[model samples]
Target: MTLGTLTWVRALDFPELLAPSTRTAIEAWVAVDPAVADAVLVTEIDPGLADTAALTEAYALPPAASANCVLVAGRREGEERVAAAVVRATTRADVNNAVKRLLDVRKASFLPMDRAVEESGMEYGGITPLGLPGRYRVLVDARIATDDPDTGPTVIIGSGVRRSKLALPGALLARAPGVEVVDGLALG
Candidate 1:
């Protein structure tokens, strides 16, 4: 499948690229949302090249075309709050203040890799907001939600597996269930 100048395979073509939970989530989403189903595209990738810097360079895509999803967690008064924050790879999630305040906790920290992977049912480097548990708050940086004239309209995000990547319009991601478009979620 091709959307504009980008080439992609139907996400259904590579089920292995998605973790079980991700597959379930995508399937459920597609069933209820035809627009998203039409918008998403997936491509196979080398797990070694899955990291943002390597993937962007290897694929010849600009750095800003990539988005990274991070899992953040915090606790307050015996209650744990978790969020999935998506930001452009060119920037960093404001976990220190913005996210901490959003989560209503004193401090927010990246969830340990092992815990993140296990809880998200995704590989450490391939966590994505699309399939996160319902308990998680999906926070998307405003920069990522808007189309940058230089970066174009689409963004490369994880496919819940290190061996594949998903591409879709930024606006479409902002419409995903439970997504919160947050200004200044990312900072230089």
Candidate 2:
């Protein structure tokens, strides 16, 4: 499978490439929607190049077709609310306003690295939307699924491990389990 400038293989055939929880979630999702196994592709890479910017540059991936999953959290009524914002690598998540409003919290900030990694059960640089704590809401930017010819149709995201990455149609990811597409979720 070819996505961006990298060649990937069916993630279903390479469960070892994904983290434990991520693989479980993908397997479960595939059980419900078998298409996921075929559509979601994975490829191994240098773990040091896992960061969005570094990966994009190293692999010649289109900036717009590469998505970043960021974990953000805030407290509302003493209850900690966490969310994973999936946005394009070219833009930033609107954490101050859009996210704060959506979360219904006075303020929002990036979840601490330790907490994010521990609770999500995924590596810090490889947090993907495929698997996350059930309590965490997934807020995908509206542009993620937009038919932008310039950006191509597929999007590359984390594989829950820094050594590999996953790619699939942005539209498919938007409809993933527990995902909510939100307009204005990204800031220019």
Residue-wise lDDT of candidate 2 within 104-167, one digit each (tens)? 9999999999988999999989999888999999999999887557777788899999999998
C-alpha positional error of residue 180 in candidate 1 after TM-score superposition, expressed in Å: 1.0
Residue-by-residue lDDT tens digits, candidate 1, 1-188: 54333468767666777877777877887888966666777887779988999888777778888899999999999999999999999999999999999999998999999999989989977888888999999999988778877778888899888988898888888888789999989999
Stretches off by above 4 angstroms in model 1 are: 1-6
Each prediction's RMSD over C-alphas, in Å, is 1.8, 1.0
TM-score of 1: 0.94
Candidate 2, lDDT over the whole model: 0.90
What TM-scores do the predictions have? 0.94, 0.96
Q: Rate the local accuracy (lDDT) of all candidates.
A: 0.86, 0.90
Let me know the TM-score candidate 2 reaches against the reference structure.
0.96
